[model samples]
Target: MSATDLTSAAEGHGTGSSVGTTDLIDVEATDFMPDDSVAGAAADLPAADVAVRAQQLTKRYGNLLAVNQLDLVVPRGSVFGLIGPNGAGKSTTFAMMASLLRPTSGRIIVMGADPSKKPRTVRRRMGYMPDNLGVYDNLRVDEYIEFFAASYGIHRSEWTALVDGLLELVDLSVKRSAMVNSLSRGMKQRLSLARALVHDPELLILDEPASGLDPRARVELRELLKTLNGMGKTIVISSHILAELEEMCTDIAIMEAGKLLAAGPPREILERLGGARTVKVRFATGISETFTVADDAEQAALLRRLLVDEGRDVVEFVEHSGGLEQLFMTITEGVVQ
Candidate 1:
């Protein structure tokens, strides 16, 4: 999508006319001066340690409650994953955090300021990538990126280098002159990500970024996210790809029916939920046995019993823990709202 499309989407266009590009760019040019009273109150809160915090956050679409009283915190410099089945309210929660949607009740702070009350503050410090990407007819990739850089009020003199760097960062340097509409779905996804990074925001909120990506593309995206996190950008991502999230996320939260089911480091949740580990043993006599152990202690005791207590000739002993996928299945009841 072009920068204009992004602006419209970011402002919640379904309820009203889309924000004009001129007005959005003009707003970007001026420094946002927040109300002193609001700023003063925010200053006293503990916002430095966390990038996002929601307390009793709720959102309703008329009679349908999209997000229940949800409470979540995303620590600074962490890759946090939000996972849920369809209708679990992950996207609704993300929209509220990105300041694109207002809550029916409750409050959320992004980068230390209330997003609904201080959207510009939150937006300036954050970048957002939605799941779907809209095509811009006849717009070249470089021009697409430059449009967003201009929208962010970056000086015209810096456009060339900024565009070059961004294209390279997303591995689209070869497609610099390619039309946005001509690019593949994966390429467009990467371009959308580059558009989000134009302003070098400290925080990124991505919803289903790997939806249309191939296996290779997904791996590239994962590595790129890790590189960005290493560079000090806090990322909040939602994906149905549980295995990928298990590999890259430092923390994860599972949601169902607009309510949080579990939240924390993945291993902690696994242990807390009694996610068992599987042990496979092979004997020199060609006998094989499988055992289920709850935790590391049990696995250790099982190994000792095989080698010492039973005095069996253990040829091979391997242990495997059910990662995020198993933990997710164990915790969520396949609930949908």
Candidate 2:
């Protein structure tokens, strides 16, 4: 459970639902396309049922370009992950998407409302949790969520059940009366998550929501998010923990030095980046064989023939696909903007 051992963490934690790699790339390329046309390199991709679309989205701080004409589209009802190295414009992108920071140039369509033109409209439909979330030390967990809910303009009549349900959803129901500062880091992280869900927004923009949590806490967080997604909430999350995102995210966008390296489902990105799948054949004679194949169908066909026609004593046949971290390394050169 070492905080730095994210590789092992990714392997240990599993999503509640099974995510198949087959046709994932094509699905992302087609279904997750932007709703409107984008300028620059992203102009060619088609549009679909997008929850958020950024067309030539850019942000510049003086001379530094924090986000460079980034074209991104998150499909509705998806758990989308935004991944990158340090200073990879992830935070900046989140800010613009949440309508917190003004983009120097470009358009951001959040749930069909332009954040720049209709900030209030977009704000009502989205809930944002920054990486450095601050808590009121004196306020109790229930009070904290209540404060935000009120601020979001929720009716007082619905407060009781709304707060209770959100607390239970994040596994903080027992800590409702506890002071925010008295809670552990994991509890506080969950509390922040509850705070974001207070308004019942259509989209949740989370910046490193699991940043300070331990391994076990991270698993709990993942399960909670899966439940939320199953309830029809669209989530856009950014984290250094690639493995967790690899399992939880339906699709991903990889950025480096304020530039996009790739965007799509992990399997699609891996396939396009020349990532090969591994086939392991274990024989009954205590011997095993492994093959790296480009085409899984062809490999499976050959393996079946050897097992059935040639009468090979095969006990187990397993295929290992490349991981998200591997795909990230291959796509980006780790360059800084």
Candidate 3:
């Protein structure tokens, strides 16, 4: 089908970090964000143009296997999401991918290079922000960004324009003179992001980058991510916040017991959850068990139209496409050792 005729698809991104109004992608695009539909898949990403590739990537710490033979791909320029329950090897896998932790076996190739063997080379082209990624307590926002810039050996003449430009992009320009330790947790998160963009690396691996942000802060961070995505930056964000992830990612990998339980577009995964689509039919009273609709398209459409056309006392009507949160709860619930 043609791109426009389809339900959802990637719109071309703009120059600044945020995507324009046309590209508010939804769906299971990734763990952190889902597109409106499966193929609303970003057109900018090259097919199989993997920025991060791990196969049978296992990490065994003594007798404990943190990551068990996991395999996945993040297409170049795609904002991918990596999700799992708490302690589901999400951080461990991120460590392995970022070359922060050594693996017991298996292979990992990121951006055409083996990070384990050529870490410095790989790191030059990649940025990493761990769940607790830290900032310099003594440095001001500008100085913090400038420090990473200098570390990258950015040109002296260019660093000023570049650092200031990025700080503004992340909305931290006002805080440029503020000491790192003085900023709130959310502000520090933004600073961490600014540091990651210092070199304009080809790939970004952010672990729960929005973890503790307040609602407004989280929304701003989400918008910033969309902007970077529009600029063709490749991203792999790991999070357990399925609702937030639902807003931004294009492709997703759900992990349990150190293995990928499901890997596909978000919408498809929900469809695979089986049974009558969980439709929440709101009325004056809670939906009674006695109230049931037949499992047929006509019945489904009628229910939908009734809600849409009449705007009845229907408080909500989310057809239970078992969402990512539900899926995560299913796979990881009580599964952690």
| TM-score of every prediction relative to native | 0.84, 0.84, 0.77
Q: How many clashes does each candidate structure show, in the order listed?
A: 0, 0, 24
Off by more than 4 A, model 2: 1-48
- Model 3 alpha-carbon drift over 4 Å, by segment: 1-48, 280-318
Report each candidate's C-alpha RMSD, comma-separated, in the order given: 10.1, 8.4, 8.8
Best-fitting candidate, measured by TM-score? 2
The sequence of per-residue lDDT tens digits that candidate 2 reaches over residues 1-337 is 1111212222334223222223312232343334222122233333334567776789999999999988887777779999999999999999999999999987777776678777887788788999996899999888898899899888777677777777766777789899999999889988898888777676899999999899999999998788767656789999999999999998788999887777777666767664677888898998998887877676778697878888999888888776888888877787887
Ranking by TM-score: 2, 1, 3
Clashes of 3: 24
Model 1: CA > 4 A from native? 1-46
lDDT of 3 by residue, 1-337 (tens): 1112111212322542322212212121222222223223332343235576666779988888789877676777778888887767989988888887877887776666677877776688789999995778988888888788899898777766776677667777778788889998888888898788778776899999989788898998888888777766788998767887877887787877687776656765655542334555667567622233334574567566676786656655555555677766666555663
Query: Candidate 2: what lDDT?
Result: 0.77
Please write out the lDDT profile of model 1 over residues 183-291, one tens digit for every residue: 9888898899998898878789999999979999899889778766765678999999999999899878888899877776777677777467899999999999999
The local lDDT score (0 to 100) that residue 137 gets in candidate 3 is: 96
- The deviation in Å at residue 109 for candidate 1 is 1.0
